[model samples]
Target: MIAAEQVRAFRGMTRAGTRSVLIYRGDLFTGAVTLVIQVVLAIAVWRIVYSGRPPVNGVDGTTAVAYAAIAVCLQSALLPWQFSSLPMRIRTGQIATDLTRPLGLMWQALGQNLGVLLARLPLGAIGLAAAGLLGALLLPPGLSALLLAVIATVAGAMIAMLCNLIVSMVAFWTLEISGPLIVYRFGSSFLSGSLIPLWFMPDWLRASIEWLPFQAQVYTPVSIYLGQTRGAEAVALVGVQLLWLVVLTLLLQAVWARARHKVVVQGG
Candidate 1:
């Protein structure tokens, strides 16, 4: 019953053509632009860093280009900004009605996000494939690696959603959440290997970040695709993501219960 309501909410959002098209178009444009930038950046980075070297740390120019392209596609496709709106919804009290729904508000939010993701996946794939071909990057391995990458990416998204929910829930206790959200976004991009790969970071910093949840959001899945980590390590990384997901979900539930009691639904 509750699941059905969640599904209905998701369908409603997806079926709303204006909203759906807006999201799809915006993400498509962003993805396309990002691919262009990534290609250029890849060439620059490779030229500067490799300096005619065959490979640095076993990663050649082709591999480096491929990694950059993949990283860009992942970053754009993931659309971290989607979570930024949560605090706004909370601040404006739009979350009150959401809280009153039969289904859990977080689950409904998750469904809506998933719908946007579904709408963007095909376009994102096309952008990624085109960029890969242009950059001469190796294709994502066979069926097994592709399947693993998909599973890992989904898990990464779940972790991202959980983190966003946690941060957004802060509006329940404070009126000013913008500062914290900004910090979170910055940290996610830098520490998650979205802006810079972990491989390039100092050993101590990389080790430190491994313990943080941001790595699970972007680095883990990309590493899996690049074969940086495999087998048990890959499994362990996914496990860590799930662990954080559960913890964040529980925390959100507790916060929502408190927030719901204080909700003052405005205007209809």
Candidate 2:
């Protein structure tokens, strides 16, 4: 059982993080617009691809549109960059002060990112609504699927946040994290099936990527949304997400232990 004080602290951090996101509402709108544009382009391409084919690999143009719509709508949360502050904190010596705080850095970071994600919810809803209006999106097949998709998405978001936190922790070892960040973003985009559904990938490649954590970030939830995963299969996919959540949580603890000890304040 969680202690009351811990719950309060988590709520407090979440509120602080939410306020930070609220402070940047303008940027959030800009991101939403960009997603709208990307969704349109993606829809056009899929339509053309399906113009001459019948549900190529079991995904039709209409289904593809719905997939892209929800995928992009939730992309903000699925691929949140709010925790990028850790590297900046390290560079400016803010992490030293952070280290002195009573709360653990991991919880603090998680709370802030959770707040940021909450702030993005309204914009994401608006995007989805607009997409639905334009026929670029479709409702989930049933209430049960929708509920399962949501659960999977929440788990996926946790996985994403933890992965980013792990990446940001690299700041403890090096001043430059650009290379690692780029590689991670690229890999996550491709492997997570945000750029292309894993269903369409070669069987061997898809099977390999499915075993990795990135797939839990975008593919699983989107697959659930598309109704490609249902019943026991849906449960298994969510199970995989939970498994990664545990594995990543443990990995983060190990990484933070070593990273905290090696922290070097660079500037005043």
Worst ten in a row by lDDT for model 1: 13-22
Worst 10 residues of 2 by lDDT: 259-268
Candidate 2, RMSD to the unseen true structure: 2.3
Candidate 1 colliding pairs? none
TM-score of each: 0.82, 0.92
Residues 1-268 of candidate 2: C-alpha lDDT, one tens digit per residue: 3477778888898998788877887887887787777767777777777787788777788898778767777775656555456788777778778777667888888887787778778777877777777788767789999999989999999998889889888878886798889888878888888888888899999989988999888889988977988899999999999999999999999998888668633332
Report model 2's TM-score to 2 decimal places.
Answer: 0.92
Off by over 4 Å in 1: 1-3, 13-31, 261-268
Model 1 lDDT per residue over 51-101, tens place: 777766666666666666666666655554554445666777777677677
Provide C-alpha RMSD values for all models, in order. Answer: 3.3, 2.3
Candidate lDDT scores, in order, read: 0.69, 0.81
Report the number of the highest-lDDT candidate.
2
Alpha-carbon lDDT of model 1: 0.69
